[model samples]
Target chain A: MGPVELGDQQMVAIQTRNLSRTFDEVVAVDDLDLEVHTGEVYGFLGPNGAGKSTTINMLLGFVPPSDGSGTVLGHDIATESLALRRRTGVLPEDFGVYDRLTARKHVEFAIETKAADDDPEVLLERVGLADAIDRKAGGFSKGMAQRLALAMALAGDPDLLLLDEPSTGLDPNGAREMRSIIRQEVDRGATVFFSSHILGQVEAICDRVGVLREGRLVAEDTIEGLRSEFDSAARLIVTIDEPTDDIVTAVRSTAGVVDVRIEEADIVVSLERDDRKAPVINAIEDAGGTITDITSADPSLEDLFAALTTDGDGTDLGVSSRNRSPGRPRATEGDA
Target chain B: MTWLHVAKKDFHDAGRSRLLWVLTALLVLLVAGVAAIPYVLAAATNDPTPTFESGLTFLFSPIGFLIPIIGLAVGYRSIVGERESGSIRFLLGLPNSREDVLLGKVVGRTGVVTVPIVIGFAVGGVVIAALYQGFDGLDYLGLLLFTVVMGLVYVAIAVGISASVSTRGKALGLVITVYAVVDWFWTFIPMSLYWILERSFPGFEDLPAWYLLLERLSPGQALSAISLTLIDTFGAGDVDLTAAGRVAGDVPFYLETWFAWVIVLGWIVVPLAVGYLRFRSALLN
Candidate 1:
């Protein structure tokens, strides 16, 4: 209706409201609303075939949305996609490199495409591919190719980065290195939006995480916030030199102790509150049970992910934060 | 700017391919062998002067077929191969629009297909000057430029098919069909069908005029007609007009030798425009 402005003052780096895409009869992404802030490393977590790549494709304007609208850096995803792409660096999922080009040439081509003057050698060195600069990518291993892709994505210091399944072909050590590079990118004032199925990888670096299931955003929060939102009950396992009935009774009588089990050498107590652990240890010692080891297992983000994504009749025991609305049938969040 | 980068990269990549080198060698050898034919004939007949008409005869036939094959070799795999390999993601991840990608492929592949043809023509020009005593440099240049234009038309057609089709195999099939229909069967099959049908009906005395137009509509036929019109190297005896060519003399302006150039221009532009429209909205997988 009006002349579109180039500079969007919206604080969000990526914001999509009711964005949707469908193929024939199958809905790949459905009525999805997502908000990712500037300078934040946002982790989009979803299982395989949960429409992660479809959403990214729509956001980047590679696949047009069947319905709704969205924007990246204040530019419409459908209209100003070229402007959006100009400022964003992307490592697309299931993408390949030019096998004829060497690793350094790939980075140089990216730099040329972006019209930037960054040194290709420095970029390759950052991605740990300096030794393979002159070698053609046709002979590269999967990890080497992935690293070259990453180097290309990071060439021009773009304002936003979209990396879909960035760790798909990396070893554990390589994954760690990739995570550190992501952290550095975030520190450079660029918002990083990456998709991953591994909860541990997301937990290590994501400032905020969104859980996607069957094309819907079930939960969106920080890692600690999500852990509390799903289920905060911590497992306090105390290993003793010998098991005693008095110690078991003392632990069971402690306040906020939901469940207590005595295995051969340990007293496992499930506590509703973390502060209740002090009284359980005191009670075990007061009953002449000598403690040898104590391990407190808090409810992890993995547990939260499983609780949010798993679909059933919604009757999982001891998961209290499953209290969200049931308006969307696909997203069974807070019903644990 | 991004399109140029893409074109440069594509040109460099296609140049380094072993298949292109092999094709170049074959084209050069074929051109050299074809160029020496007039010289051999002149020696056998004891004629010191080989006319330019003899020089243009065999050169046009083999090159008429060879240009389409070289164009197919370069352009058939430009876009569909990238789409299949998923490198299109890398290309689009940059600042380029879909038009840039398609146009870059057209230009880059045109360079790949045209370079060897130019080299072959240059080598053939050297041999022609040495063999044909009455060889006109201007006429030779016109023939060389016309051949290059025909080569570009086929390249556009091949690249157009590459962009319009969804799979590499489909692109391959479509380009091969284009070559077969336009070069090999455009004149023969339609004329044969017309004669067979006329014999049954007993109403049509001669082949229909539109059939002649259809034959001339092909890029190969248009190039042949346009080259003869542009440079009159062929003597009356050397020029054996087909049925269409004989009828072409009395037809309207649209069916004249000058109109073949228009067909050549259409051959270059129409397929590319259609392919560009189809490619603009194609969902990259």
Candidate 2:
């Protein structure tokens, strides 16, 4: 959705208008305009050095933007940063916890920092860290430390949560738990804006995903939307009683059918459009092959993400420009 | 309130460390040892009354060296260590500005370093009262408070270097250079300048009064000047009024003993002010 459309009805959790940050000659984030709506799980996907963290740091006001402006939770990021931080919960990338403090103490410190009245015990228990509550965090494993950090981020039940690489050190099981917690928070009417380099981590939870390439946002849409936009191939698999050359030839000759292959008990046909499935099934039946069952599978999000992130020459999108003006937002056509 | 929360957390973090505790214990022992000197002199000379000047001078000399070490040890990693280890981003992620972090650190570290000085002086004061014949309570309290201010001056310097440097190693090197030049080798500058001028002109006999004023900028020298002014039994009789009338028209205001308090206050404010200006704009990686 456009920022104008969302701004009319619902609040924007984060909106950056022509925000840019530069480090000497290199442009970290370039002429970026981003909008995230409230009460939605927005996935920020990018590779390393894709300006995801820089954009986040700018929104948090940890680093000043070289030009342009932005706002978080209705507060200006440049002029009213402390107000922005007061209502926002952030799990920053490469954030370190005090080694001497215990897990419980870290949560308590967060509670005090945010001026929240919630009990630290409940926050730690929610993150499944109650068993190690009193132990010093210096002895924690990477996964445990991540849990404590997440608990700290969840303090005060903030209106907006900005998690940068939230599952960086989590194992598969821990990552699943983290996702469930993120879902619970979103269900509770909180807006979650999290970034991850891995596509699989966000595909299940994100209501909308914005993919960043180099210093620019290349695409933003729902998972299903991205699939239809990029992936054009669908596969139809038919269980046949017997393999026949007649069936193979007949299926291959159907309209929109790209290729036909016969496995042990199934005959599979790749078609360019879903409407061609009936023709392929009729062709197979006319060839005297008895079909027991039929099923069709669309291209998954993994394929769409790979295709969108990779350029036509099979290289990762490496486009970054130093010539763009600071306060001018670039025009891109993809809706949220 | 955000700065107070941050400062309270920092105070607890530093106060609980075993290294700081060990350093404070050593300082307490050193103060007790200094306090025992008058008793030792009385025992050796078979006289029951030991002069007050000898006791105050011996105690003040070693403290001129120990207080800076304790202060630097407590404050050397206030800011740059956090940046190097990536915890600064975590601190900034909360509802805190960069000014809060720097100022909170100064307050937290100043409190941590003051604990040792206050304890050491308290122990030293007890020993002086029990042993020395003419120990004055009001003068000793004034000296003790001045010592705490002196320790805070070094804490400010250490925190300023911590805030300005990008790496902990670089901050350590710079703070140590500051300690070396200001605390240990401040008088060397004037002596070196006098030797060079004499070799060139052949009749540059006495050091300029302005050089003494320049040396007063060091926190250690400033503390010494204040201590001498408070004690009154030593360093008061050494000013040569007739010799002061020989070369210059009048002495600089900073050269006066009473003006050293201003120099101490400058040491506490200047470094942190300069550092906060740089830290406010520098990018964090």
Docking class of 2: medium
User: DockQ of candidates 1 onward, in order?
Assistant: 0.59, 0.59
Q: Which parts of model 2 are misplaced by more than 4 Å?
A: A1-7, A231-298, A313-336, B192-209, B229-252
Model 2: per-residue Cα lDDT over B1-285, one tens digit each: 588877887887788788667867876777778868777978999977775556766777677777798788778898988898777877888888888888889888888877877787788777777777788767677667766777788888898888888888988898899988887788777666756766542222244676566556678777777776666665445554222332255666667766888888788889888888888876776
Error of 1 at A232 (Å): 3.1
Query: Which runs of model 1 end up more than 4 angstroms from their true locations?
Result: A1-10, A231-298, A312-336, B44-49, B188-209, B229-245, B248-251
Q: Sum up the clashes in candidate 2.
A: 1
TM-score of each: 0.82, 0.82
* Weakest ten-residue segment in model 1 chain B by summed lDDT: B199-208
lDDT of 2 by residue, A29-71 (tens): 8888888988899999877777889999888877899988887
Candidate lDDT (C-alpha), each: 0.79, 0.78
- What value does DockQ give for candidate 2? 0.59
